[model samples]
Target chain A: GAGVSQSPSNKVTEKGKDVELRCDPISGHTALYWYRQSLGQGLEFLIYFQGNSAPDKSGLPSDRFSAERTGGSVSTLTIQRTQQEDSAVYLCASSFSSHSEEQYFGPGTRLTVT
Target chain B: AQTVTQSQPEMSVQEAETVTLSCTYDTSENNYYLFWYKQPPSRQMILVIRQEAYKQQNATENRFSVNFQKAAKSFSLKISDSQLGDTAMYFCAFMKHNTNDMRFGAGTRLTVKP
Candidate 1:
């Protein structure tokens, strides 16, 4: 079975531009999550969606960061007015459900803001 | 709020030797899950092992095992007979029962030297 997949494996953008990163969770997965990994650091939680309930946006660093999951499967994370500090690897993951402990991760999309 | 901690930033072990990565988390919830994930330069997060809070027995996957001390809020991963392919960043994560929110710790980079 195909694991989670992220599009535009690498993205380079201007500091002030907006960028959208896409994630395709495994088929039938009802839980999706986004995380940011800075160089030489740990994974930072961003946001997550489960079923039809409202997504958990508490981990989002700022208003510039937002995500949306459509049809309970695909998710997109958008960083508006990106800053140099936004440079990092953005990873997406999915589980069988919210109760499932193990999450399958995608080969992240590295975003570089210059 | 809960937080995960990884005390070791970097470590090394000879091939075919054994090494353990320490992880501690602080949480008030009684039910949760602990996980160990490995990420190499390829940037894909792989689930190494997982332990449920309610389980007294440690979780093991072949050469990978965990020392889960629920009372102490500790979850350490032990890799026996380490191989070169085991060289990567190991991340410890926590998720509350039935919740999709997962917290991660600062990773420990393990270098398997021949």
Candidate 2:
């Protein structure tokens, strides 16, 4: 089976530019998650989507960060006016459901704001 | 909010030996799940092991196992017969039974030297 996959393995953007990271969850996974991993730090939760329910954005650090899951499968995390602090590995994960035992993570998209 | 702590920033173990990575968490919730994930240099996160809070017995998977101390709010991962491939960043994560997100601790970078 194909694992979760992300595009543009590496992206370098200007401080004020906008960047979008895409995630394709496993074929039938209904629970999707987005997290940020700062250098030498733990992963910080970003957003989550479960089936047809509303996405959870409580973990978004600021209004500049937002995400959307369309057709209950693919998700996109969009960062507007990126900052140097936003330079980190953005990881995407998915599971069978919110209650599933484990999450499958992608290779992660490393974004460097220059 | 629940908080997970991995005090050890880094560790190294000889290949074919045993090594343990410690994790402690603080949470008011009784029913939850704990997980250990391995992230290699490629940035792919893989589930190494998991333990359920209600289960009194610990969980083991092949060369990987967990030491779950419910009362102490501790979950440690032990790798037996460590291999060079086992070198990676180990993360401890916690999630309420049906929560929308899992909180991760600052990862512990483990190096297996031959």
Candidate 3:
């Protein structure tokens, strides 16, 4: 089976520009999550979606970050007015369901705000 | 709020030897899940093992095992007969029951030397 996949492995954009990262979860996976990994830091939780339920956006650092899962499969994380601090690797993961413990992760998209 | 901690930032082990990575989490939830994920330089997060909070016995996969102390809120990963492939950043994560959100700790970089 194909693992989770993300588009635009690397993205470099101006600080004030907006960027959108995409994620394709594994087949049959109903739970998806987004995380940020900064240099010399741990993975920071961003947002999560499960099935048709309302997505959890509490982990989102600021209002500039938003995500949406279309048709309960693919997800897109959009960052508005990106800052230099937003420069980091964006990772996406998926699991069988919200109750499933193990999550498979994608290769991640490295976003560099120049 | 739940928090996961990995006190050791880096560790090194000789090939064919054994090494342990410590992890501790703070959570009030009675039922949850603990996981160990390995992230190589390729930037893919791969699940190594997982332990359910209700389970008394530890979880093991091949040479990878976990010492899960629910009472102490501790989950440690032990790798026996370490191989070069084990050289990567190990992350300890916590997922509360019935939720899609996961909290991760600061990773521990393990270097397997021959």
Q: Which candidate is the best by DockQ?
A: 2
Model 3 lDDT, residue A51, Cα: 92
Candidate 2 colliding pairs: none
- DockQ (C-alpha based) per candidate is 0.79, 0.81, 0.77
lDDT of each: 0.94, 0.94, 0.94
lDDT tens digits, residue span B1-114, model 3:
999999999999999999999999999999899999999999999999999899999999999999999889999999999999999999999989987668899899999999
User: Lowest summed-lDDT stretch of 10 residues in model 3 chain B?
Assistant: B95-104
Give the per-residue Cα lDDT of candidate 3 at A60: 95
- Candidate 2's TM-score on the B chain: 0.98
True contacts kept of each: 0.81, 0.81, 0.77
Give the better candidate number (2 or 3) by DockQ: 2
Per-residue lDDT, model 1, residue A112, is: 99
> How many steric clashes between backbone atoms does each model show?
0, 0, 0
Q: Candidate 3: lDDT of B77?
A: 99
Give me candidate 3's TM-score against the actual structure.
0.96
TM-scores of chain B alone in all candidate structures, in the order given: 0.99, 0.98, 0.99
* C-alpha lDDT of residue A55 in model 1: 90
